[model samples]
Target: MLDLLVIVILLSLVVMTNRRLAYANETIHAKWLEQNLNRLLAYHTAFSFLFPLLPGDASGYWGFTLQQVTVHSNNMFDYFGLGTPFLLFLDFIPVKVMGLSFLTGNIMYGLLGFCGLRYLFLLYYKSLNLDILVFGVRTVPFLFYLPNLNFWTAGVGKDTLCFFGIACFVYGIQFYRRRIISMALAAALVYFIRPHVAFMMGASLAICVVFSGRMKAIYKILFLALVAAGAAVVYKQVLGYLRIEDLSTKSLSGVASDTAGLLEQGLTGSAVDIQSYPLPLKFFTYLFRPLFFDVHNVLTLVSSFENLAYLVILIKALPNLRRRDIGAMPMWMRTGLLIFLFAMVVFSSSLGNLGIIMRMKNMTMIYLLMYCTWSISRRKAELAARATLTHN
Candidate 1:
């Protein structure tokens, strides 16, 4: 009854805010995509929830230990220390309380993803001072309606958590300067959910602090030095938590090689020889593979088109990437883009599975999309200003 009452209230709010939602998209496709993605996630949850419930199930779905581990064991840190169990722990609640139905658990994830998306957009807009509602612009729709980002992230899994964590980190840094508690909370999310990403984000933040002209050199150096020391401590802690021994560079490469070998063998149909590629090539593949020619299915086909669209924007922006142009960019935007680029190179080198790649790309792609949007908006403002001056 309580759940039903909550749903009723949410529905009422949706109806009341229908006009505002319409303003979010000019066409119904983005709206429909959100609804459909939620339904798809629910259907997936319905099918997937059964695997763990069945006796002798050993498929290892979503990184959980089947029925043996309950939601109470989520933060047990010792038993389930590695891999992503936070999202599974979240799903466990609705399943335990509301009878494990798709409507209950998956709809909850759907709403979580939706909130994640909104938070992501807020991070971008606020960081760049972007106007999503520029009078005649249609480009904002792509940010909301990108199929792979929506479909993969709008589900009950680590992708949703990644989205939520990265968004929170960006928001905290961009908006709540000097607010250590908020930033720490956001960093904690990223650390627990994806520790390497937390490190990457921390690196970007430190770089931003060091290079920022607004602060005194001594202050910047002191802050950066403190941050670097903290990151080293956190890195050691993360290594200990994961129980991974051997901190040598050779061991790191071995791990990446072994992971690549498994991805090549395990992820049938999406396998590629990532082990053969150099680092730069791996980065390129990570950012822009599954190209139009590489499309083997409807999903990849759609992704190809999205890639093509973004590629055009990148091509146009490349020549304009002058030192002055970069200097003109907001500090947070510069930090976010560098973080995205660095994270992509890291993830791409380590991961070879196309499905995983598709899901993980959402973490960085939002920043790129926002950078493009901001660039376009800034150019238009410049043109409008010049026209006004000429007329005057």
Candidate 2:
């Protein structure tokens, strides 16, 4: 436990030191020293390379740490290479070839984020101003604090990619309002990134088009259905083929994931013991638990703080709930919020415990951010429309 605490501290200090540097270098995320610099420049500082690569496994593979590649070193021979286990995918190359290690992987991961966020900002530019970019920037703070993000976003997971797809779908809808031809193509591109999500987005797009109330636009419903069905079919076929390939070729390939193996066993065993523990009965506790969250990497508990932030925003937003009528918000905003909320609730339903809420809270943070961003943007749009009408 002492060693764990020390590692966490090292992580905290590294983040503190590099926090400002990230803004300055714009790419401070790349662990320069870890890259095995063949030729150091006159202005290059050695700490640049070493600091981001320091050992910090509590962060899993993507945390600021050196020798971080070993976190998934076991998977070096998955051979199938169809898709990397979440963490292994990102760490696969950057950590080896370019030495992009911890911070750098995230910066690259953030590029996926940038794609999504940039799309949103461009679409909502009239409402989402420069201040909203700060919100986009803040996801970094949230990302750094999650031990899971190390692997989920940077190492090899699809969360960033998923968000990118969602953002593209939204942008496509807005574009379809004016440029119908491009809508099918934009929607199809997001689908290629993560077909499952793209299918869902396509469904939502269909619904939006159906109710858009423009008789001339009703034909879009068919286009959306064809697109949604096509994307889903492609995704299913690809995933199925990959799984079959894995069984035949990589059957013996996954044997190297020693750590993941142990973790899987421990999870299975503990799940059996869950009912025996007093945890399930401690239900109400986690709802407000983070205040004193200290034991398991307290720094990673930024998720709890994010939840708190959501609640505060909810409190401030209570006034809007007073009118208690559906017509209060714009049609697009209301419909989008409902679909986004549905996706979130469906996603969070899987996490079923308290003491272990640490992992689950990550999902909540993501959903809450999505919700808050939408809410703020919605209000801005409503205000702008009212102003335009008043002036006219």
By TM-score, who's the top model here? 1
**Candidate 1 stretches greater than 4 Å from native:** 1-82, 97-100, 126-137, 177-180, 216-229, 241-266, 278-280
Cα lDDT tens digits, model 2, 1-392, are 44345334544554444444334433542354212111111112222233244233323544324342334343445422322233455455555544544544444554444444444433332233222322344322232232332223332234555655555556555545675555555455444443334444555556655655553654765666676677655754645633433322122122212223333432321122222325433332333334334324433365456545555555544553434333433333444554454443332232333323433333224433444554554565567889999999
User: What tens-digit string does per-residue lDDT give for candidate 1 at 1-392?
Assistant: 65666545654554334334434533645465345334433443343333233222122323355553454453433333333454454444455444444434434454555555655543443333334433244554445566666665544555566676666666566565565676677677667766666777788878877777777889888778878788777777777754467444344444544545543544456656776789888876777767877777776787777777667666655653456656667766777787787767666766676645666677778778777777766666677788999999
User: What C-alpha lDDT do the candidate models reach, one value each?
Assistant: 0.59, 0.41
Candidate achieving the largest lDDT: 1
Per-residue error at 321 for model 2, in Å? 3.7
- The local lDDT score (0 to 100) that residue 286 gets in candidate 1 is 76
The list of candidate 2 runs beyond 4 A from truth reads 1-103, 121-125, 128-156, 177-195, 235-296, 322-339, 353-392
Scored against the true structure, residue 192 in model 2 reaches a CA lDDT of: 45
